[model samples]
Target: MDNLLVKTGSSLKTFFTELGGISIMVFKAFAAIRIRHNFIPQIIEQFILIGKKSLPLVVVTSAFMGLAIGVQVGFQMTGFTPHWIAGGMILRTILIDLGPITIGLVLSGRISAGIAAELGTMKVTEQVDALRSFAIDPIGYLVTPRLIAAIFSVPALLVFSNSIAILLSYVSCNMTIHITWNEFVQGMRYSFYVSDLMTSLIKSLVFGVVLISLGAYFGLNCQRGAKGVGSATTLAVVWASVSVFVLDYVISTIVFYA
Candidate 1:
C-alpha cells in the first residue's frame, strides 16, 4: 500500500511537471511567431507542409468515418419509420466530436512526427548550431512558423473534414435509405447546437497547440544522433495523442459544467 501510494505520488508530480513544460513551449512558440514575421518563404512553406500535405489523408479519413457512423446509427434506428434519423445523428457526431478530433489526431500523428524529426535532425546535425552561431534565434526561425501553421492548419483541416464528413454522411443516408435532403438537414440543424460547434473549435485549437508543442519540445531537446532523432519523433506523436485525450477530458468537463 505504501509503495503504491509513493508510485502514485511520483506519477502525479511527473504529470504536473510535463504539463508545465508544455505550457512553456506554447508560450515560446507564440513569442517566436511575433519575432519571425519577416520570413515569408518559411511561413508559406509551412502552409504547404501543414495544410496541403495533410489534405488528402484528412479528406479520406473524414469520408469513411462519416459513412461508418451513418451506418451504425442507421442500424440502431432501424425500427423507426424512415430509418433515416441516422443522417442527423451522423452529422451531430461529426460536427461536434469526430471531425475535429479525427483531424487533430491525424495532424498529431503525421505533422507532429514530421516536425519532431525535422527539428531533431537539425538539432543533431548542427544546423541548429549554425543558426545559433549566426545569432539567428533558432526558436524564432524554426519553431514559430511551424507553430503558427499548426494553429491555422489544424482548423483548416477540421473545417474541411466537417464539410466532407457531413456530405458523405448525407450521401450514405440518401443512398442507403431515401430521405429528403431538407428533412435530413433540418434534423441535423436541430440536433447540433451552435454551442457544441464552438466547443469543438476550441478543442481543435487546444489540440493544435498541444501537439505542436510536444513535437517541438521533444525534437529541440533530443540528445545523441540519428537514433535519438528517431526516438524523439516516435515519442512526439505518442505524447501528443495522449495529451490530446487528457486535454479533451478537461475541456469536456469545463464545458459540461459551464
Candidate 2:
C-alpha cells in the first residue's frame, strides 16, 4: 500500500511538471514569433509539409468513415424511421464529432510522431545546442511555423474530410436504401445549423494547437539518446491522441449542452 501510494504521488508530480513545461513552451513559441523573411518561408514550407502531405490520408480515412456511417445508419433504420433521416445523422455525426476527431487522431499519430522524431533527433545530436550557440531560438524557427501551419491546415483538412465523408455517405445511402440525392440533401438541410459548422471548426482549431504543442514540448525536452528520442516520439503520439478525445468532449459539452 505504501509503495502504491508513493508511485501514484510521483506520477502525479511528473504529470504536473510536464504540463508546466508544455505551457512554458507554448508561451515561448508565441513570444518568439515575428514576421521576418524566414518566418513566411518557413510557414509556407510547413503548409506543404502539414497540409499537402496529410491530404491523402485524410481522403482515404474520410471515405471509409462515410461509408461505415452510411451502412450503419441503414442497418438501424426501421419502418418508423424515414430513410431520409440517414442524411441528417451522417452530416451531424461527421461535422459535430467524427470528422474533427478523426482528423485529430490521425494527425496525432502522423504529425505528432513526425514532429517529435525530428526534434528529438536534433536534440540528441546537439543540433539544438548548435542553434543556441548561433543565438537562434529553436522554438521561433522550428516550433512556431508548425503551430501556425497547423492552425490553418487542420481546419482546411477538416473541411475537406467533412465534404468527402458527407458526399460518399450519400452515395452509400443511395446504394443501401435507394434514397435519392435530393432526399438526402433535404434531410441534411432540415438538421443543419450554422452552430454545428462552428463547433467543428472550433474543435479542429483546438486540436491543431494541442497536437503540435504537445509534440514540440516532448521533442524539445527529450532525454539524451536514440532510445530517448523514440520514447519521446511515442509519448507525443499517445498524449496528443488522448488530449484530442478529452478536448472533444469538453468542447461538445460547452457548445451543445451548456
Candidate 3:
C-alpha cells in the first residue's frame, strides 16, 4: 500500500512538472515576440500555414455540418414550425456556436498534429540541437511561429468556416425547404449577435493556444529515437484535444456570465 501510494505521488508530481514546463514554454513564446523584426515573417508564415492551408478542409467540413444541421432541423420541425424559421434557427445555432468549435477541432487534427509530428521529428533528429549550436533559439524559431500561428489562425479559420457553413445552410434551405436567400440572410442577422461572434472567437483563440502549447510541450520533451517521436506526436494530439474541451467549458462559463 505504501509503495502504491508513493508511485501515485510520484506520478502526480511528474504531471505537474510537465505542466509547468509547458507553461514556461508558452510564456517564452509570447515573450520572444518582442525581441525582433523576425515576427512579421513568422506571423505571415503562420497565417498561411494555419489559416490559408486550412481553408479547404474548413470549408468542406463546415458546409457539410451546416447541411446536416439543416436536414435535422427540418425533420425536427416537421409539423409545428415554418421552414424559414427552422432554417434560420439552425443557421443561428451554427454561426453562434458550432462553427467555431468545429473549426477548432478540425484544426486540432490538421494543424496541431502536423506541428507535433514535425517538431517531434526535429527533436529526435537533433535539428533542435543544431539550432542551439548556432546560438539560434530553437524555441524562438520553431515554437514561437507555431504559437503565433495557432493564436491567430484559429479565429480567422473560425470566421472563414462560419461563413461557409452559413452559406451551405442557406443553400440547403433554399433547395429543400424553399427558404429565400433574403429571408435566410435576415434570419442570420436576427439570430446572430456581435456578442455571440465575440464569444466564439474567444473560444477559438483558447483552443488555438491550447493546441499549439500541447504540441510544443510534448515534442520538446520527446525521448530518444523514432519511437519516441511517434509517441510524442500521439500524446500531443490527445492532450491538445482534451485541452480544447476544458478550455471550451471555461470560455463558455465566462461568456455565459459576461
Candidate 4:
C-alpha cells in the first residue's frame, strides 16, 4: 500500500513537471519570434514541409472520410429523416468536428513524430549543445519557426481537408441517396454557422501549437542515444494525439455549450 501511494505520487509529480516544461517551451517559442529574421528561411521551409508535402495524404484521407460519412448518414436516413438533411449533417460533421479532428490526429502522428525524431537525433549527437556553444539560441533557431509554420499550415490544411471532404461527401450523397447538388447546397446553407467555422479554425491553431510544443519538449529533453530518440518520438506522437482530442472537447464545450 505504501509503495502504491509512493508510485502514484511520483507519477503525478512527473506529469506536472512535464506539463510545466511544455508550457514554458511554448512561451519561449513565441517569445523567440523576436529573432525571426534569423529563422525566416526555416519558417518558410517548414511551411512547405508541413503544408505542401502533407497535401496528398490530406486529399486521399478527406475523400474517403467524406464518402464514408455520407454513406453512413444516408443509410441512417430511413423514412422520417429528410433526405436533404443529409447534406447539412455531412457538412457540419466535417467542418465542426471531423475535419479538424482528422487533420489534428493525422498530423500529430506525422508532424510530432518527425519533429521529435529530428530534434532527438540532434540532441543525442550534441548538435543542440553545439548551437549553444555558438551563441545561437536553439529555441529561437529551431522551435519558433516550426511553431509559426504549424500555426499557419495547420489551418490551411484543415481548410483543404474540409473542402475536399465536403466535395466528396456531396458526391457520395448524390450517388448513395440521390441527393441533388441544389438540395445539398441548400441544406448546407441553412445549417451553416459562422461560429462553427470559427471553432474549426481555433481548434486547428491550438492543435498545431500543441503538437509542436510537445514534440520539441520531448526531443529537447530526450534521455540519451538512439533508443532515447525513438522513445521520445513515440511519446511525442502519443501525447500529441491525446492532447488533440482533449483540446477538441474542451474547445467545443466552451464554444457551443458555454
Candidate 5:
C-alpha cells in the first residue's frame, strides 16, 4: 500500500511538472513569434508540410467517416421521416464535433509523433546544442515555426475535411436511401449555422496548439539516448490525442452552455 501510494504521488508530480513545462513552452513560442523575424520561410515550409501533406489522409478518413455516419443514420430512420434529414444529421455531426475532433486526433498521431521524434533525435545527437552554440534561439528557430504552422494549417485542414465529409455523406445518402442531391443539400443548408462553423474552427485551433506545444515540450526535454527519444515520442502522441478529447468536451460544454 505504501509503495503504491508513493508511485501514485510520483506520477502526479511528473504530470504536473510536464504540464507546467508545456504551458511555459507555449507562452514562450508565442512570445518568440514577435522577436524572431527570420522564421517566415520556415513557417511557410512547415505549413506545407503540416497542412498540404496531411490532406490526403484527412480527406480519406473523413470521407469514410461520413459514409459510415450516413449509412447508420439511414438505417435508423423510419420510412415516414424524410430521408433528407440524414444530410442535416451528417452535416451537424461532422462540422460541429466529429470533423475537428477527428482531424485533431489524426494530426496528433501523425504530426505530434513526427515532431517529437525529429526533435528528440536532434536532442540526442547534440544538434540542438549546436544551434544554441551559434547564438540561435532554438525555440525561436525550431519551435515557433512549427507552432505557427500548426495553428494555421489545422483549421484549414478541418475545413477541407468537413467539406469532403459532407460531400461524401451526400453521395452515401443518395446511394443508401435514394435521397436526391438537392434534398440533401437543402437539408444541410437549412441546418447549417455560422456559429457552428466558428466553433469548429476554434476547436481546431486550440487542438493544434495543444498537440504541437506538447510535442515540442516533450522532445526538448527528452532524456538522454534512444530509449528516451522513443518514450517521448510515444508520450507525445498519447497526450496530444487525449488532450484533444478533453478539450473537445470542455469547449463543447462551454459553447453549448454559454
Candidate 6:
C-alpha cells in the first residue's frame, strides 16, 4: 500500500508538471506569431506538411469508418424503420461524434508522432540551441508555423473527412440495404442542422490545438539522448490521443448542456 501510494503521488506530480509545461508552450507559440518574412512561407510549408500529406490516411480511414457505421446501423434498423432511417442515423453519428473523433485520433497518432520525432531529433542534436546562438527565436520559427497550420488544417481535414464519410455511407447503404441516393440525401437533409455542424467544427479545432501543442511541448522538453527522443515521441502520441477523448467528452457536455 505504501509503495502504491508513492507511485501514485509521483505520477500525479509528473502529470501536472507536464500539463503546466504544455500550457506555457501554447501561450508562447501564440505570442510568437508575427507578420514576418519567413512566417508566411514557413506556414505554407507546414500546411502542406500537416494538411496535404495527411489526406490519404484520412481518406482511407474515414471511408472505412463510414462503411462500418453504415453496415452496423443498417443491420440494426432493418425491419424497424425505413431504409432511409439508416442514412439519417449514419449521418448523425459521423457528424456529431465519429467523424471528428476518428480523424482526431488518427491525426493524433500520425501528426503528433511526426512532430515529436522531428523536434525531439532537433533537440537531441542541439539544433534548437543553434537557432538561439544565431539570435533566432526557435519557438517563432519552429513552433508557430506548425501551430497555425494545425489550427487551420484540422478543420479543413474534418470537412473533407465528413464529406467523404457521408458519401461512403451512402454508397454502403445503397449496396447493403438498397437505399437510393435520393433517400440518403433526403434523410441527411432531414436530420442535419447548422448547430451540429458548428459543434463538429469547434471540436475539431480544439483537438488540433491540443494535439500539436502537446507534441511540441513534449519534443522541446525532451531529455538529452536518443532514448529521450524516443520516449518523447511515444508520449506525444499517447497523451495526444488521450487528450482528444477527454476533450471530446468535455466539449460535448458543455455544448449539449450549456
How well does each candidate superpose onto the true structure, as a TM-score? 0.91, 0.98, 0.89, 0.97, 0.96, 0.97
> 1-258, model 4: which lDDT tens digit per residue?
999999999999999999999998889888878754657889999999889998998889988999899888888877787777888888889888999999998898889999999999999999999999999989988899999999999999999999999999888878887889998898999899999999999999999999988989999999899999999999999999999999999999999999
Tens digits of per-residue lDDT for model 5, 1-258? 999999999999999998898888888888888644467789999999899999999999998988887788778666798876877888889988999899998999889998999899999999999999999878988899998899889999999999888888777777778888888888888898888898899999999888888888889888999999999999999999899999999998988897
Off by over 4 Å in 2: none
User: Model 1 residue 219 lDDT?
Assistant: 89
lDDT of 2 by residue, 1-258 (tens): 999999999999999999999989989998987889858988999888889999999999999999988888877775778877888888999999999999999999989999999999999999999999999999988899999999999999999999999998888888888889888998899999999999999999999988999988899989989999999999999999999999999999999889
Regions more than 4 Å wrong, model 1: 1-14, 35-37, 81-84
Q: Which wins on TM-score, candidate 2 or candidate 5? A: 2
lDDT sort, best first: 2, 4, 6, 5, 1, 3
Q: Which model, 1 or 6, shows the larger TM-score?
A: 6
Tell me the whole-model lDDT of each prediction, alpha carbons only. 0.80, 0.92, 0.79, 0.91, 0.89, 0.89
Off by over 4 Å in 5: 35-37
Stretches of candidate 6 off by over 4 Å are none
Q: Candidates sorted by TM-score, descending order?
A: 2, 6, 4, 5, 1, 3
The better candidate by TM-score, 1 or 3, is 1
| Preferred candidate (lDDT higher): 4 or 5 | 4
Give the Å error, residue 92, model 6: 1.3
Assess candidate 3 and give its TM-score to the true structure. 0.89
Predicted candidate 3 versus true structure: per-residue lDDT over 1-258, tens digit per residue: 999999999999988998899999989988777556756787788889888988899989998998887666656666656655764687658755688678768877887788878888899899999999999887888888877777777888888887777777777766666767777667666676677778888888888888888878788888988888888888887877777777777777887776
Model 5 residue pairs with clashes: none
